[model samples]
Target: MNRILRVKEISELLGLSKSTIWRMRRDGLFPAPLKIGPRAVGWRESDVTDWIKSRDRLQ
Candidate 1:
C-alpha cells in the first residue's frame, strides 16, 4: 500500500513552509505532487523521502 502524505505533513517533515513547497511546484522545480481527488493532493511518502535524500546528496 502506498503511504501518502499531504502538503502540511510534507512541510512539517521537510521543515519548510507550505507556501515554499507550493511555490516550488508552481515553478516546476519540485517533484510533482499527486492529486488523489479533485479537491485533494498529496505526495507519496517514498517520493518525499527520496527527494530529501536527493537533496542531502547534493550537499
Candidate 2:
C-alpha cells in the first residue's frame, strides 16, 4: 500500500521549506498533493520517492 506524507514530512525528507515546495508545485517541478480532506493535502510516498530519484539523475 502507498503511504501518504504530510507537508512537514515532505519538507524534512526533501530538505526544503514549505514555501519552496509550494513554489515548486506551482512551477510544475514537484508532484502535486492529493486532496485528502476538506482542509488537508498529502503526497504519495511512491511519487515523492520517484521525484527524488529523478532529481538525483539530473545532478
TM-score of each: 0.89, 0.96
lDDT string for model 1 (1-59, tens) is 87999999888887889999999989976789888999999999888888888888999
Cα lDDT of candidate 1 equals 0.88
Candidate 1, number of clashes: 0
Best candidate, TM-score-wise?
Answer: 2
Off by over 4 Å in 2: none
Q: Which candidate is the best by lDDT?
A: 2
Instruction: Please write out the lDDT profile of model 2 over residues 1-59, one tens digit for every residue.
Output: 99999989999988999999999999999999999999999999999999999999999
Residue 30, candidate 1: C-alpha displacement in angstroms: 1.7
Q: Give the distance in Å from residue 6's predicted Cα in candidate 1 to where it truly belongs.
A: 0.2
Cα displacement (Å) at residue 58, model 2: 0.7
